[model samples]
Target: MKRHASFLGLCCLLIVAALLGGCASLPAPRPVPPTYAIQDVASTRLARIAKQNALPGAAELSGFRLLPEAPFSFNARIALASRAEKSIDAQYYELRNDGVGRQLLRELRDASLRGVRVRLLVDDLYMSDADELFSSLAAYPNVEVRLFNPLPARSGSLLSRIVFSIHEFGRINHRMHNKLFIVDNSFSVSGGRNIADEYFMQDGQANFIDMDVLASGPVVREQSAAFDIYWNSEQVRPIGQVASFDLSPEQAQRRFDQWVGGAGHGLPENERDALGRTSVAHQLDDGKLDQFHAKAQVLVDDPAKIMRGRMEERFQGSVSQRTLAVLETARSHLFITSPYYVPGQVGLAQIQRQLQGGVKIIVVTNSLAATDEPLVYAGYARYRKEILKLGVVIYELSPMLSQRSGRLGEFGKTTGRLHGKTAVIDDKRVFVGSMNLDGRSASLNTEIGLVIDSPEIAADINRIISIDRYTSAYLVRIGATGGVEWVEQDSSGTTTAVHEDEPETSWFIKSKNWLLSPFVAEELL
Candidate 1:
């Protein structure tokens, strides 16, 4: 009987392996219909403001507003959506099916209902829970939903699909990390935040300190063109083509109503009123910006980057490469904030060259206690000492022993992990977008951001994040005996106590990470 059971288990294992291996597949590519962004918006409210107040071709980089506060940043999207006249094109790495996410969807549906065209492109990694919602949303007239680099097997859960379809690992491993949102091709917002409660600071469990740049003028048009490229790429599949539209138009309408109506986590009426009063639409209606104006250019990775073998030689013009090229021009202080930081050997070499050149560089990243990915923390830990010894200033976010005020103030009350991917050079140029200072963002995932040549923008970003770095993070440094130490800071931004170990992390976790970090690949983080 024991032999029989062992033989049965072996057969089961063989069958599972066969099923997994069989999932390795993609048929001939389905031809994507070409669609370009609507560039003629001479009469729209946004165009009136953008064109009137836009910096001339002299500056090159144009209208921009930094969004650091979560509530205000999120409100900006709704404001744009509410006022979109002709079209709204938005894409993101993730969109949770939570309250705020559903609210955003409802806004899109409402815009579509008003004869405004709506297009949403999302990465397929997190769509297992939201695929049915996408199917329903796609049913609305004038609303289109698509997935970029969709996983072939969608019937099972995301994990099961990955387990069964291990054959498509090459394509499945790469993803679209880019986030771009445009209204009427006149105004746009591009940055690290996805359409989720945590991104917007509504997540009760935890949140991210994120950044985005809302812009107008020439930059918006360039952003629209980038969106067109992804929308027309063969790798992007319409929601209907990828998932069954089980909900009919009538059924979808009722469901959409339910989804939107059930979302009770929207901003309070008073906060909404405050945001509306200060909206760009409100300020721009008079044809000028109460915000900073600067020269800027949009950078985006090609969608085809994810459609091919990741090991293939990379091409130029990638967002990261372009941003780094801009960084190469840095002449003074360099400030970098990447929540999931694992600077591999190549990145470290580059940093060393800059440090050797006397660049005052400051890096702010998540500590082991605050990081969302402990395995990623393991990867980051592999080079933590090497990085510290290179004379670079490093600040790892500490959620437990931090004081708060302004945007950084919320970290003390709620769990806050740094999610802003930003770098400022000499306080003259700022790179804000979705690119992290890590191998995954550098090569595997597609990214987008603006390289702004504006001191005003850079200064504002530096000011807000500097506040967080001083108050909410541990200053990692080489101790007297060559060991690492975490220096805590007071609310007054003065260094106080020193801890010999990772302040909030347990010994078991630290030991496990120390032991397992050797196998954690930086490129996969």
Candidate 2:
């Protein structure tokens, strides 16, 4: 009887170990303190400065410039953080502890040391690895870091967190997808680029073709206000309260210094020199960086979007709604570029209606070989044939495009993937922001973007697209037999047929997509 009992005990222990290893058990929620508002601190400080200097009001026209090159975009962000005299505000969806992430953290820490109040808000879904870093940054008196929609168990593997929070998945899955960086409350950068090596062309394995707009006018005020809304929302929790860590200010400073000194040390000398040469701040100071004046409006989703059922009531004035409204007004042409393009039946119908009304529609999105999210691509693939039937033109970015053809010339041997989310209507209005044309973006996530009323900017974007799309992408069309075939253009402007959805994609990827498509829910993709 004793031997039998020992065997049973061993079996039970093995079962428990298996469960924990596979993330099959749910984790208990921990207690947290109540959240309070931080107020619009950055804007208030900027208002005082503007009044003292006799500057224009926050509602006046603003200056806007596009940062299409990744190196310049990264440099602009560093310059903003370095030059911030009073306050800095930033919010992002994902921030890794890799190359770009470390550099930004060091810059923010240095800015804090110089007496600049740095406030950062990041989505907590991907914060499992960065909890310690955030806690260390929060140790500084001048720095504050918050995580939006934090999980019940703050530290764990990604699968474990998902399984443990499975019951609350509906709420936890809704993330804040806004990417905004404001300095001194008077200048801001808002668009699709997150804080990562891929977004900034630093990752040699894969680089994202992204876009950002640097604004220094009335639009910055609106962006600042949106940041305040999310910063003060009850859904945001301080990183210190969520994760337990005890790092002294001195220790934090030492870590930051090491990170800063070691950053880019592995890069070749030419890449580093290229990065140093495209400094927008230096050009602006020397009266070389050109800018465009425009009337711009910042649109953001309600902070209550983090709430599951309450999101519908607040969806009326959301960024998605405003974007659809703008699309409805398009009469001549509509140009759209989204990395993840999963427009459901309703969106397709809307596009069909526009097509019937004689409007030309052109869309550029990631091909299966280039997309980082194959599941999302599966969801998008369901609509390709239906969209083609409506006479709309579609282009998928090539995964094997040469690095020399990339917007950032410094991207060495990196595979290019489309990450910019933009739309142009009738060459009169332009939309650039974090919103993707997918159901998740429309109903599940909170997004922010800018609508600029400037024909000059619109024309510039139209011209770029007209020139680049044919060279860097595969044009999808209906074949003679009524099936899809990809067409490509060679360097000599010679066009040829490539008869596959993604000719360059590996068989493993194709098989994975084929197997996963049946199980993936379109709304969740």
Candidate 3:
């Protein structure tokens, strides 16, 4: 009886110790500045940038040019950074420290060295080892770096961060999904592509078929305004404050030079020349670059979106709201391209309403085989039949399609995945930005995009969509018996029907998706 009692006591002691250790492993919330200080910074920065860059009736003078190709898009950003005489502000959802990221960092560093003030804001959820590099970059005199919604403990490993996220899922899951690059308060690029190798086709294994719009005039100022809001928000912490690494300016510069100089060593000479020749700076200096003019408006979610427990009433003028307003104005047709599409009941109802009004809707999204996020695909898969029944034409991109349509250099024997998020409404307006047509984009994460009143741009995007439907995507339709079928065209102009969710998807992948779909919460995807 005494031995039994001692065993029970020992078990209780172990349980208590385990509980204490678990609590200790959890991340402690970092301290932030006082509310007054945060408010002061926000107000001051907003007012100052508005006064300096805002023009009277500036909307009438806005202009936009589509950077449809990845190489051209990459070059445009580097050129803007190289030519920026006054300031450069950039914000992104992810900034991997790969070859493409290093090259852009080098450009920003060179710009700073030439007396341009540079501010970079990046989301911290996927920052990984880039924290130290950002810390080093911030050591430059004319440059500053801030991370949005950073993890509490910078020393924590990825597994610890995941555990912390499970504990604080509500706050940590909501991210800033905005991508903007503004230079000199005059030019900007806002779209789906983040700063990484895969985005620029530098990743040999996989490359994203993405899009960006190069804008000047009024819209650029609007993007800068959005950047200022995020930059000054309380959630944004300086890299120097969060990262433990301490390196002097000279050391940082040397490290940056070494990284940048070593990039593109293995690339073929032709590809290297292609990257070098498409420089916007060279074209602008030679007076050969063409600029298109149109009325443009920048739409972005409120920075307060990152705050937890906010009422839905607070999201009155959100990016999604603005997009829906534009959609309401659609009279003839709507074309949407989203990589991960899971339109819930609200979206379904909206499309049904549009269909009832005789408005044609066409959607292009990634297939199960082409998607990088199989869980997101699972969420989207359940809605396919319902959407097809509602008379919405759907196109699923195939992985076998090469990225050869948009004047982007041919990636030899590469698999294509849809990553561009865009919409063309009635061939009158075009939207290109970082907002995905998923539940997370709708009510969870913050997003940003540009609405350009340019029929030419809308028509161009529509043409691309039509071409992709025939060449690189499968048309999903309901059969006579209420089943769904995928129709694709062959190289010899022959059409075939594929009676599967994704014809090219592996059996194991299909099985995994089938097993996981029943367990996933669609709204969180």
**Ranked candidates, highest TM-score first:** 1, 2, 3
2 or 3: which has the higher TM-score? 2
What digit string (tens of lDDT, one per residue) describes model 2 on residues 5-93?
12112222433444653333223334554332233444454434333332346346677777777767877888777777778888998
Which candidate wins on TM-score?
Answer: 1
What candidate 1 gets wrong by more than 4 Å, as runs, is 1-29, 56-61, 264-288, 308-312, 315-317, 402-413, 491-493
Cα lDDT tens digits, model 3, 163-185, are 44344545656788899988777
Q: Give candidate 2's error at residue 145 in angstroms.
A: 0.4
TM-score of each: 0.91, 0.86, 0.85
Indicate which candidate wins on lDDT: 1
Using lDDT as the yardstick, the better of models 1 and 2 is 1
Candidate 1: residue 474 lDDT (0-100):
91
Runs in model 3 with CA error above 4 Å? 1-59, 155-160, 264-279, 308-316, 403-409, 490-494
lDDT of each: 0.77, 0.74, 0.71
Worst 10 residues of 3 by lDDT: 1-10
